[model samples]
Target: MKDRAVLYTFESVHQAIKGEDVLRAAGIACEMIPVPREISLSCGQGLRLAAADAEKSEAAWRQAAVSWQKKVHACRVDGRYRYGVEN
Candidate 1:
């Protein structure tokens, strides 16, 4: 719970919107953000959630069948974000 962020990039805007609603209904806090530059060049939406809630969010997504393309874990370092890995 170190303020780390978990980013979930979806294949489509509909999926991203659906994902946000699903997570919210599951009691997982999440935000919809522009897909990160490194993740995709095309304009797209992503769901950002607390890293501490990653597991819960993942389960919720799976149960809801909310499709997503990627899940990346990022940490704040020196006031900048550093994406460490993907899953």
Candidate 2:
């Protein structure tokens, strides 16, 4: 198995859902994950993808003209969470 990465975050669930549809339409592999507690304890969701595919996913979202407030972050799923730049 391989580690995964988070692609983007939206201010509301509706935006996240719409973004998910756009990413899927663009042929990007993505799923909705609970927003990390570090960011918010609320039930907000975000899009996840394979770390290797993060860049492509971001580009696809941009090309689709989706509006998102936060940038993507690279995350490793080990016991320890590591954060990196969007790329």
Candidate 3:
């Protein structure tokens, strides 16, 4: 879906880095970005990925035993997307 994005949140920057490492090992491309305001009120890092990869990405993390805070899925609405948490 166009304009769709997925952000995997962690408890802290360090946890985000650890999750990033495991995802990289699994060959799933992602970026470390600040937690989107749509997702959190506090400053922290998040692993961002294509919306298409959200589910598989979370699965990959779980399979690797990498803990994550939450997954936010964004979908285009009114030419923009809003983030909402997913388990």
Candidate 4:
């Protein structure tokens, strides 16, 4: 499979920060980033992590009661990013 990354968009800044905390607490590496233009226009905050960590990140957030508004798949090519499927 192609190397993939995950993008998580939040409904608010608080949720984004909470999500990052949850992931980090669970030992999953993630970073806060700008929500992609294709995702939404409202919240500008999101989280980025390797696709390998997606499942663990999801579990961490749910277990910690951290809510995210959307999850998107990102394709990384030649160190550049292109939008992928949104869930």
lDDT by residue (tens digit), candidate 2, 12-78:
8888888889878877778888777766666788776777776776677678766676655665655
Q: Native-vs-model 2 lDDT?
A: 0.70
lDDT of each residue in 1-87, candidate 3, tens digit only: 456778878987888888899889888888898887767888999887878777787888788777898877766567765677332
Q: Which parts of model 2 have CA positions greater than 4 angstroms off?
A: 72-87
lDDT leaderboard ranking: 1, 4, 3, 2
Candidate 4 Cα misplacement greater than 4 A, ranges:
85-87
Judged by lDDT against the true structure, how good is candidate 4?
0.82
Best model number under TM-score: 4
Which is superior by TM-score, 1 or 4? Answer: 4
Please, what is the whole-model Cα lDDT of each candidate in the order they appear? 0.83, 0.70, 0.79, 0.82
RMSD of each: 2.3, 3.2, 3.1, 2.1
Model 1, 1-87: lDDT tens per residue? 245888889999999999999988888888898977887887999888878898888888889998888888877667766665532
